[model samples]
Target chain A: MVKTNKQKAGNIITALLLIILGAFMFLPIYLTIVMSLKPQEELFIFPPKLYTLRPTLDNFSSMFDILDNNRVPFSRYLFNSIAVTFTVTFSQCVFVSMGAFVLAKCRFPFSKLINSVIVTSLLYQSNVIYIMQYAVMSKMGIIDNPLALILPSIASPMGLFLMKQSISQMPDSIIESAKIDGAGLFRICWQIVIPNQKPALMTLIIFAFQASWNMQGGSLVFQEQYKTLPTVITQISTTGIARAGETMAASVFMLIPPVIVFMLTQSQVIDTMAHSGIKR
Target chain B: MDKLKKLWCDVRKNRDCYLMLAPFMILFVIFTIVPVIMSLPVGFTNFNMAQPPEFVGFDNYINLFLSDKVFTKAIRVTIIFAVITGPVSYMICFLLAWLIDGLPKKLRSIFTLIFYIPSMANVYTVWKIIFSGDMNGWLNSTLIEWGFIQSPVQWLTDSRYVLGVTITVQLWLSLGAGFLALSAGFRNIDRNLYEVAYIEGMDSKLQELVYIVIPSMKPQMLFAGVMQIVSSFTAGTVAQELVGFPSTDYKAHTIMTHAYDYGWVRWEMGYASAICTVLFIAMYVCNKVISRLFKE
Candidate 1:
């Protein structure tokens, strides 16, 4: 009876600790949602209300109005973000997978050098090459193009590394048998390797999508006309009239696509991370 | 006929793979490699975007190191931020992971999702609201209502508090991937090791954790540490925004923002490149030392 009581006390303590931590994690999100619903007057009310007294869509409507008046087409920015994200994600998966396959299966000369370079690049952040990236983009006259953002970010050494790790785990005899059957590198990679790499591909897709979607610096560089959603949302929230609710609304909108992508690919991402020991 | 057949087979076999890879390589060279190389030469010039670059070899690097006060402050700030936040955040994440490891699977997943949502949410905007200078600010209002403070604190504008706020946010936003990775590591531990320890009458806590947990989580911990270091070094955006430009007497300016100021706003490409090179070397050396120490 005493032991059971001790166990019960321990369980309660554990539950309380988790609940507190969980609240800390959820506070910002909850506040944002509440702020988005509250009117401007209610926003600044002393002793800050936890829930909206009167929920309204005025904040959402005003955000749109502001966008319209400023000649900043929010839809265009959203579309550009979506387009760039999908294009970059899709391309990165294909390229990274191919490179991974080649490195894993193909016995090419200078493979070690290539692998080293890829690893170095993976560890290196864009800030290291910021000056060069800007200069080259200017020289190429692609400063304001979406390609400037999409093209550079797609050369993902991390993706290649993940693919290599995934592909290396495959039975070597399978590739050897394919080679014996007169399967060339390309045929073997496509027919045998890619189909077998569904988990890695899905993980890559999630990572690529998240990276592209959350990309702030790269998108900030080029394409003034074709502003990505993050830039647009940031600009709106920071520079414009200080409507807290509208800013929250914009943030909420900006967050939805990645959340959807995360939900769709969550299981795959978790599974891949478990098996392959890759973290994004 | 043999040559024709060989060519046909090659085309049939390698085309898809090449096509799949072409986009990445082409894009990488154009955006990444070319730009990196291009930036190197800029370090030798004094060219603003409006004017042609005039060669002034080593001048930028010399000025940055010897004369640029902002550059020095940036380096200091970045190092300090990284030094403080990197280890603390890692510990917090690991602790969270450890705590969650004790939960039931279904409850653990729910908690994990909740913990990770803050990271996924629009961080910049949320922070802006939380730290809003107005009395309506959630943090300020709450504190005032609770009588914790007599007056509102200028959390964002005050230079002393800015870095702290930035680090706190960093800790909050940094919980997801590292925690998830460690949790996964915990889940994958060999149950037999713990069983053996228990049979040997080893204490439950030490048996389950020190013996079974830490050893199994070495790889995950290493990966998380390396990633945290890289991110902490590069991540000054929150600080940049919160502290405002010029960094409130240059206290909050990190190497990244300084590089941006020189490269973009001032168009001093050479100077920016020099700073970037310094940052890269510093980060590389740090990564090397950490990796050697951990030896993962």
Candidate 2:
């Protein structure tokens, strides 16, 4: 009876602790949702009300109106974001899987060197190279074009590493048997490799998509037509404190897609990480 | 002639593999490798996108080290932020993952999402709202209602509090990939090992964790450690994003912000590159130490 009581007390303590941590973690998100729904007058109130009895979509509607009035419509930025994200994600998945397959399956001269180089590149600070990236992008005339974002993202070494880790875990006999059947490298990659790597591929898609979505474009794509959704959100939000409501709404919109992608792929991602375990 | 023929034969034998790797290597070399190489030389030049670069050897590095007061402050702030956030968040991730590991799958995933959402929803506006300096701000409003304070505190602006506030936000956001990795690490631990440890008189959960769990999760821990270090060092943006750029008297200035100030704002490419080089070296050295510590 005493042991049962102790266990019950422990369970309650654990539950209480988790609930508190969860609430703390969810605070900013909760605030964002409430602030977005707030009417303008309620936004500036002292000892602010956490919830409003009368909520409105006025902020979002106004933000959309403002975006619609810009030289490049708000829809263009959204479309650009979706297009750039999908293009980069799809292309990177294909290229990374191919490169990863070569590294994982084939025995070749200088393969170790190549693998180490790819790994080391993960540690290299890309912020340091943003200037050069811009310089090259300008020289190549890809500036002010969405391809500037897509093309650079295709070279993502992390994607290649992730795919490489996934592919290396495959049994050697599968490839050997495929080779016995006279299946070419492309055939094996498409028919066997990619089909089996769905989890890694899903994780890669979420990562690439989120990264492309968050891309700032820096000085590369300066044209209003080419700017992505995040660029537009930051620009509008940074204007002033008066449009705090609209900024909250914009943040909510920006937050949705990644959350949706995560919800869809999180189980697969967790599975991949479990197996991968940060192993080289 | 013989060597050339041998090389050609080797290449021909691996034609399919080379063919598969072609597209990625081409883009990687052009966009990644070349750009990194180009950035190095820019450290030695005085180029402001408006004019051609002039070779100026070590002046940027010298000025940054000797005369830049803000640069020193940036270093101090960055180190403080890194030292606090890196280990605290890492331990938090590990501990929470341990606690949550025994929960039912549905509940576990829900908790994970709740914890992970902060990182995903890292919008500047949300933080701005939460840490706003007015009485209407969430923190201030709560504090006032509770009578903890008589007036609103400048959480974001006041240098005394900015670093702490930024660190808190950073710790919230720091439950990122490392957290996910550690959670998965805990889940993947062999259940039988715990049973065996228990039978062998591992009396406390602490003993089990120290003896079996941590040792077994070394790779994940190392990966998480290196990642935490890397993430913390580059986390200059959070302060800038949250507290407004160049936060009051440069209190929240970090190495990354310092670099950004020079590189983007001041248009001093050479000096900025030097700052970045220092940051890169710092990250590299820390990574080396972590890898060594985790070496079996």
Candidate 3:
């Protein structure tokens, strides 16, 4: 395990490169935190500052103040965000898991067509269909409702694709044994197969939570009370340059929960992402 | 009648699978499938929200390729964006993931989080502070201080810098899920394979990568390629977020932005659907081609 001096130098070079690249990646997210804490005087400095000589929490208080002063209280926005986020994430895990199990194991008519459709859907940008989607959402009577933010996100192709890739990696023997034991399809999907796919489930949970946490019913759901925190935060952000500090504070506010969720489950997510691709 | 009976029996035999799939399928159809399918028919029509969709045949698409100046400019900007950022960011993701893999676990996780946070945190808008035109903006002031420019560059507003600035920001957010997949792909490789390859006569790390790592990580690479291609082709949000929509002179206009400009801003749903359809087809074809290349 002893490294030669030449080998040590190469290793040092590699470490140096990683640090430089890692810093580039980390800069904006770090600046979000750093800039949020800057005092008002620092905001207008000629050649704006990257670091604050005088740090303060006044920006956050003002952000909170703005939230407090809104026609919709901050708590209502927060509540909508939390309720929608939790419902979408939980339901996605359940529904995508169920569908992914059949997609992985069962050979029904049109299964191949369904699988191809789902794969192509993964590559689709939801923006492409937004105009039509608004119409569809209205037709479903979910427009201007909390369901606008929650329902469509509950079963993404990405979630189904992730779970299907993981589930198919499970041996058929295990499912076969469960089937022979007279376990119903639902039991096998939920009780038996799913428990063993923690990494994949965690991956779905992280993505779903991240997407839902940041979901804004922007133009889709017109009601103020039903909109998520991000929609409200963007409204706060429009106060212009004099209020940039509060905007930064609001950005930090919206970012915190997802970052926390990501950190908590990242190991599982990292493990699962590696294995999420085609069977080939 | 015999074939119908056999099909019925088969359907009954696997009804549990149907039952398992129906809930997700219903939601998926309502939310994802139906909308996308509906857009295809809309692409051929002249429909606004106010009126009935009049069948327009190929007029919308004909206008896009033959008449729309902004659409052509959008295609140009998008291709420039895809060509530069797509491969460059893919290599950076791989290289960063490879180096981070070399670090200890604690540092590894921290580095991953650091690189991964921007995409998650909606950091595109945060870049506005840096690209802001005033002397108070970070990039502007820094360039002034360094004597690179006499005046604060309108980084976001200027036509000169919009594409570059947007490309830079898109690259920042590009690590995303694909990077994580590659990093974990590195971890899952059996270390013993490396030792065996080394002892069997591999001397350089590059050799080890070609011989040992890549052969074991095909699936992850394919996934990363598909993700990188999709993100690059669909990279309108970063530009629209960083620069204003219908960016100055349409310099930063992209297919996605063009679609957004028409669909949302003007409510010209018909033409917008055509633009969206074109972009989606381009993305899907690019994905299929990249996946094919990755397989090879």
Candidate 4:
């Protein structure tokens, strides 16, 4: 009877601890949502309304109206973001997979040198070369183009590394068997390796999608059209202080694409994490 | 003759694979590889976009390290921001992961989604509203209502608080990625280890964390640390916007902002590249130290 009581006490303590930690983890989000929905006048009410306030969509409406008058149409920014993100994501996957395949399966001269260069590029971020890149882009006259953003990101080191690691895990006997059957390298990759790497591929897709979507600095430097959602939203916040509600609304809108992508890809991403023993 | 023929056959057989790989290789050379190589030359030249290049040798580097007060201040600020935010954020993520690790799987997923939602949502926009300088701003309104302060504090404008505010936003956004990564790490640990500890009378929370959790999560922690360091060095955008350009008397300025200011705004490409080179060296050294410390 005494042991049972002790066990019950331990369980209660655990429950309480979890609740407190969870609340702390979630407080910032809860605060942001509440702030977003609160009426502008009552937003600063004393003791602050934790609950018990009428919500309004005035913020959302005002944001759209403001976007209508801007020189850079907000919708265009969204389109540009979608275009850049999708292009980078899809391109990175194809290239990384192919490169990984080459490095994994093929015996080629200078492979070690090429792999080292790729790793070096991966470890050193673009911030290291932003100034040089700016000069090059200026000289090339492509400073404000979408290609500037998409092209640089196509050879992602992380994607290549992950894909190589995944591909290396495939059973070599299968490839040997395929070779015996007179199937060429390309046929083996398409028919066997690619099909087997579905989980890793999905993980790469989600990762690439998220990274490209949330990219801030590249978009900042690459486009003058306010042609990306992050750039547009950043501009709004920086320039439109008086229209606080509109800024929040715009931010809310900017967040939807990434959130949807995350939700859609969460399971696959988690599965990849499990298989590879890689943390985020 | 036989060796040459074998090589020929190999090339012919792999031609299709090479074709498949061509686009990436071409783009990589043009974009990533070329820029990295070209960055070194820009550090010695005085060409703005409007003018012809004039080689200036080590003058840019000399001026940055010697005469530029703002550059020095930015380096200091970047270090401060990185030190303050990186560990605190890592701890928050670990805590969240530990808290949610034991919950029912369905509930855990829901909670993960909820916590991650804010990070996915328009971060800059939400932060703009929350940290608005006006009394109408969310933070200001809350503080006033709570009677914590008689008047609204200029959270973003004041040099004292600007870095703090930036760090706060960083902590919030970083929670999801790091937390998710660590949680995945936590889930993969051998459960039998924990069970064994429980049987061996290691019942204290600290004991479990030290012996089981931390040891198992070494790799994840190292990765998170490296990522946080790199990001802290790179992440000056939100702070620049919130704190105002030149960083409120250069108090919140970071190495990234200094490079941007020189390269883009002032059109001093040479100086900017020199500054970037220094920052790169710093990051490289820091990463080396971290790797050595975490080496198995």
RMSD per candidate (Å) reads 6.0, 4.0, 3.4, 5.6
Give the per-residue lDDT of model 3 (tens digit) for B1-296.
99899989998999999999998999999988888888778889887879989999999999999999989999999999999989999998888878887777678878878888887786654688878888877877888899989987888888898898889888988888678667756765656677777778777768877887787767567667777887888889888888888788888898888888888788888898888788888988888788788668
Of candidate 3 chain B, the 10-residue stretch with the lowest lDDT total is B184-193
Best by lDDT: 3
Please, what are the lDDT tens digits per residue for candidate 1 over residues A187-257?
88877877766645655676688788977753435455587867666666653225668988876766678
Second chain only: TM-score per model?
Answer: 0.83, 0.90, 0.91, 0.84
In candidate 3, which residue pairs clash? none
Q: Give the per-residue lDDT of model 3 (tens digit) for A98-207.
A: 99999999898879999989979876674547766888999988888888888999978877876776576566888888899999999988887887676567667878
Q: Fraction of true contacts reproduced, model 1?
A: 0.41
**Reproduced native contacts, each prediction:** 0.41, 0.47, 0.55, 0.33
Candidate 2, pairs of clashing residues: none
Give the winner by TM-score: 3 or 4.
Answer: 3
**What would the TM-score be for candidate 1 when compared with the true structure?**
0.79
Model 4 over residues B1-296: C-alpha lDDT tens digits? 99889878876766766776677778777777878997677778896767877998889889988999888888888888878777788787787677777767677766767666655665565566567777767788888877888888888888788888888777666665456556656665656677788889886667899998887677566555666666777768867766778767777788888888887788887777788788877877877787678665
Off by over 4 Å in 3: A4-7, A126-128, A168-196, A267-280, B1-4, B184-204
Candidate 2 structure quality by residue, lDDT tens digits, B177-230: 667666656655656677677688666667878997887677567656866887
Instruction: Give Cα distance to truth, residue B247, candidate 1, Å.
Output: 2.7
How good is the docking of model 4, by CAPRI class? Answer: acceptable
Decreasing lDDT order of the candidates = 3, 2, 1, 4
Top-scoring candidate (TM-score):
3
